[model samples]
Target: MAEFTSQGGILRGQDVVSILFPVAVIPLLFLLRSVFFYVKARSQFPGPPIRNFWVGNLDQTMANDVHEKWLQWNREYGPIFQTWNSPFSRVIYIGDPHIITEITTLNWPKSSAQYAGFRPLSGDALFVQTNHEKWRIQSKRLAPAFQPHVIQAQRPCLAKHLSNFVRAMDVVAEQNTVVDLSSLHILLTLDFVGDIAFGTNLHAISQGRDCRILQLFEIILPELMKCGLFPLRGRFPILQKTRLMYRAIAELRSMAEKAIKDARQKGDEALGTSPRKKISDILATQREPDESYTFSSKELCDNYIAFLVAGGDPTAHTMSFLIYQVLCHPLVLKKVRAEIDANIPFDTTVPSISQVNLPYLNMVIKETLRYSSPGFGTFRVCPVDTTIAGVTLPANTTLALWNPAVHRDPKLWDNADEFDPERWQSGQPKVRGSYFPFSSGPRSCIGQGLAMLEMTMTLATVFRRYDLSLESGFQMEYLPSFTLKPKNGLLVRAILRKF
Candidate 1:
């Protein structure tokens, strides 16, 4: 009787404890997680706190011009500072030369979460490739074709397309109507990129019609930028407009795949004795004995999309901004005009690399790139726990290097914000990381040589043939998207210059 009573009592006690244990531990676990995050935040790098526990700084910075916010914060908090992006994540913004040089040279993989926004369009392409090894392989394979000589090999093709561009502008000039230079430039760049990249003329300029792909590209950025910051964008039906953009991008992918197939079938026989290589041709012809070294058709499509994303906006916006800035400053325009008149022959279809000796022209372009950097910033993630800029960054921590902030830093140049092209001609030794319009180190823009050549040639071609002036009392305002664009667009009056 005594043993049975003892066993029964023990069983009842065990049941009571089991029921209470979880009740006590559930809240305890919640408390422990909160404590862990708090401790981590305090122990790791310093950063500004978010507005709330649930959303962090998303509420404050998500809707606004985020880059402008970064610039403001950069001004407020020295060269290196951190901001809580979410309860689970913190972002460290680095613009200091030493820190930027270190992170970029190390070629830190971009933070996967931050760059996930870029994936829907350019899947695993060079810009959105989260895997470092894969990125390295792709970058190396693509590097040789972007070299100056290789880019120059495409000059004749570029000149042919540019002549079409000039004819389009000439038609508008003949009408004597105010031209939206911004849209015109965007179309021109799209056609140029399409021709050079895919070996197809989109005919956006010559036909004076908007390419569906280009239109898709434009709307995608503004919506995607929002989607990138707000995860719940899909929950709202109105913002669901981005779905159409995705569908359009899918259609574009199909177009690219077809173009590649057609190009492969045709071969380089069209070029005959002298073959000029386009990016599409290079991609089609690339052969590797090892299966591992070869790129798949999908990979090629993704790469061409990356080219469009990177090349399309930056080129057009930079050119548009350059024209706006030049028109805003008369003396700057006169100096550039003088340089063009002296060096470039009036009827020269394409100034050969050696024939183009416009120092001031080069300087002006460099200064514009400095003054209005199209790529305002870049994202990098620390791969390993490392110290940078006198602070320790845990692995997977996201860092942003704000280029415009660095560009406009008063300490870096004399009157940095002033429109002064002569600063480059000052003969001062260049600061290494201070002005990287194309970025620097291993992963810098491979298309930079092509971009510079195109800009120089286009500027010489257009300004030599036409005199452009901004509409009277015109004002320029910027819209922050994937690239800084003129909010109102660039309106200009064009007159044929009698040489």
Candidate 2:
């Protein structure tokens, strides 16, 4: 009996060892791998000291002032430096315009690690798609909808929405109320994009409130930032607010599905009859004789969401920043208003795309894109070992084209920190990689033409009618999210201009 009991005890001890051994060994291996990479990265490039071995500099990278931090690091460690997102993930930031030009010109693959967060919202859409062939096909098919002519045709539609927006503000001005300008920009852009992309009047501007879809986006974007920087959060439910994200995603997809159904029904009635095609019409229509390129119902929904994700927020944020900058600098505001008054009629006449030609206005737009870039940066990866600017990076290494740093680099600009529209007054060719707010290369933003038109017309219409002043005692702060936005929203008093 005693011998039998001893044998059972020995077996239980062996079972415990079998389970614990791999657990101990796996972490040890991970630690060694992290150490090896750390040593290798340190030898090759200069970077800030590692604050934590486990999370690395991820906390700082995710902070609200991350752009400023990158600028500081650029000054201290040179234009090119390395940082670890986590113990296992390595990132290299390139702020040197020459190096950035070289990398973008080559058209290297986008970094999956950086864009994985978008997959939850965008799926295999062009913005988040990593496959070159798939991206090419998608880009080709969608290019027509954003052609200059096509976007120009939508000018009337844009102007209609802007008229509603201005009227909404006119009421605010009459009340002598301080309003959150950022929220108003969000509503205006949402309504315009909703009309163009989904063929539905969200009435976000006319109704003077955000729709359910917009509210869902607000929830989804922050979660995307979390998943984007820390990829594991995307894969594992426990690591993120999966329930909230999934619910929002489900609702958005459901809305997209309904839009697709409506578009299909409308197309059946107007088959080969309509000349002008909305974005939804283009997305929903099947590719004749080339069924392979035709989007599945799911793909249609995903791409629909992609258009919403890309179109609305970034442009709105850019406008908000432009307003903030103009308001802060009274001289810039005077110059912009004077230019507007001199060229555009003071009546409620929204100018056509070709007619809205204010040189100083264009300069202000350029300077705003540079000084307060809405996009944080773009990411890329090399398929093989590559050397850029004297540093050799291994295969699949994530590289960031740090736009904020590049735009503010002293080597690239004069008085880089100042908001000077005059910097562009010379009309000289820009330093190639120094001012890519829409990014560069084949993967650049396709909707940039539309965004520019919207901005020009909106600015002209708004400043022509109203003189805006920043709320007293209001200081600007940025929100910590995928894009740079005002933390507390842009508060201003809109005073109706007297002719």
Best model per TM-score:
2
Q: Report lDDT (CA) for all predictions.
A: 0.75, 0.82
Which residue pairs clash within candidate 2? none
Find the number of clashing residue pairs for candidate 2: 0
Candidate 2 residues 1-499, lDDT tens each? Answer: 1222355464465666777999999999998997887687666778878888877887787777877888899989988888877766878888888778888787788999878867877788877888889889888878877887888888878988888888889989999999998988988888888878877788887565447877888878877877787777777868446558867988888888888888877877887887755767776775658544367777777777877777788888989999999988999999998988888776765766765788898999999989988887778899898877776777888888879888888888999999999999785667888888988989888888888888999888888888888999988787757687788989999998888
What does candidate 1's lDDT look like per residue over 66-105, in tens digits? Answer: 6566656666766677766556666676768787888778
Q: Which residues of candidate 1, in runs, are more than 4 Å off?
A: 1-16, 19-27, 35-49, 227-238, 268-276, 290-293
The candidate that wins on lDDT is 2
All models, RMSD in angstroms? 3.7, 3.8
The TM-score of candidate 2 is: 0.91
